[model samples]
Target: MATAKTEKLSASLEDYLEAIYNLSVDGSVARSKNIAQALEVSRASVTGALRILAEKQLVNYKPYGYITLTKQGCIEAQRVVRKHNIIEKFFVDVLGVEHTVAQKAACEAEHAFGPQIVEKLLCFIEFVNSYNKNGYDLHDEFRSFFRKHGSIAAGDSN
Candidate 1:
């Protein structure tokens, strides 16, 4: 379930929150310059986003001070990060997408999918993992199929 705070956040703000959460994972708070560097946005843009996040009670921010996530912010950031990871894993592990391409795609897709879809994707990844563990190798099979047929269509046969 999305919190009101998270629901109200724009994708850009969510990105900022995720960046902060990742930065702070090293046991240090995030600075504005670091956030800017992470997101590839300008320092002014980072300041503006930080101010908005602070107003929403999503971050502990003071000008020129290290920033940290509030409890709610951490929850929301975790949600975003989870979505990104699930999508990236699906793309890379299941679809055989390049890691860099999957990373970029996941960044865009993370904000678009809701909890239900994300959960389903995670479950699907688990199912694929199980299949691989059981010696099924769905990923390899799909790659071979794609190489032969170029694409799957209705009534396609092995």
Candidate 2:
């Protein structure tokens, strides 16, 4: 289920939050220019987004000043980041997806998935990890099977 706070945020806003969170991870406050570069948006766009986030109480923003997430913003940003990482992990580890492709896909999918689907994905990933720990690499087996069969046709029993 999505929280009311996150529900009110657009995908663009979420992206801004994610970018700011990542930029600030090195213990430095994020700058508007850095945010614009990270998102590949214009400085004007970044300013607009920062203002909106500030109004939502998700960030502390001031003109020509560094930006930082509020406590609630950090919580929301962590949620978004967690969903992205979990999706990326599942895509790469379970589906045998290439890392770059999975990263791009995760970025797009994170904004759309709710907590329930994300939780299920995490469970599935954990299940796969357990199999690996038990000396059965399900991902490797799947990759080998795919390589051998290419694409199995419907109703084909080979």
Candidate 3:
């Protein structure tokens, strides 16, 4: 079942929203160039997405003018950013992936996790960060532990 927020979000939309949110942090308005560069997307693509966001009332987009998120946009962007950061940390620190690889993986992962799972992952990372310096090995250890202790129930289907 799709949650209300999940239903309203798309990976592309979230990326633009998050980009605007980041750009808006140091200033009141977000430039299209900044968003395009941050997302590594074409300016034309950014323009299209901005149009869509504006139609949804998530942002205020005026031709050739700076973009700014509406209140609802900011809330959604914060959630996306949080998911992206948490996923990146998990991939880099727990999975032992290279930083850049982890970042790309995070871009894909953020969409897969809903709010509930994202929060659980955040807590897991916090716990791991508290005592471990093993970086990548920690993820292997976790998998091994889960394999040893967490078994599928007899009635569970493949």
Candidate 4:
């Protein structure tokens, strides 16, 4: 399900798109200064990225003005966001990672995997959730097994 926009989006561009999408989640205009703050990048950098995105028809960018995604842009942004969320959930729920750690790791991973992997991951997460609801308690079982066989030094509960 990869689109032209998605296929050509570099990791840095994807980050900017994700930031803009998150900033404008409530239908507000995403200003360049705001985008700079959100991404911790310079306003010049944001502008450059916005230019590329605009050329790709992913964003409607005007000089020194607020930014907004086109319909195709929004769809691509949502796909990226969904991948990030799925990876984060897998880290937290299945791997027992800390919330912050999971979020950071997912941020890195979101750009690596493609739509097919992300869709499969979503299904795996749903299956695990349903399995847990059916009293499988897979998380606890993993924790128990890890505690018994984990290679970390003694007295480490993580």
Candidate lDDT values, in order: 0.87, 0.88, 0.82, 0.85
lDDT of 3: 0.82
Q: In candidate 3, what are the lDDT values of residues 126-155, reduced to their tens digit?
A: 777675564555656777876788665546
Global Cα lDDT for candidate 1: 0.87
Q: Find the candidate with the highest lDDT and give its number.
A: 2
TM-score comparison, 3 vs 4, better candidate: 4
List pairs with backbone clashes in candidate 3: none
Q: Per-residue alpha-carbon lDDT of model 1 for 38-120, expressed as tens digits? A: 99999999999989998888998888776889888999999999999999999999887778888988999999999899999
lDDT of 4 by residue, 1-158 (tens): 44545456788888888989999988787889888998898989998999999988899988966689989889888988888999999999987777987888899899999878988988988887677555767778889998898776536433
RMSD (CA, Å), each prediction: 5.7, 5.9, 8.5, 4.0
Clashing pairs in model 1? none
Error of 4 at 77 (Å): 0.4
Q: TM-score per candidate, in order?
A: 0.87, 0.87, 0.74, 0.86
By lDDT, the better pick of 1 and 3 is 1
Candidate 4 matches the true fold with a TM-score of 0.86
Report residue 8 deviation for candidate 2 (angstroms): 2.2
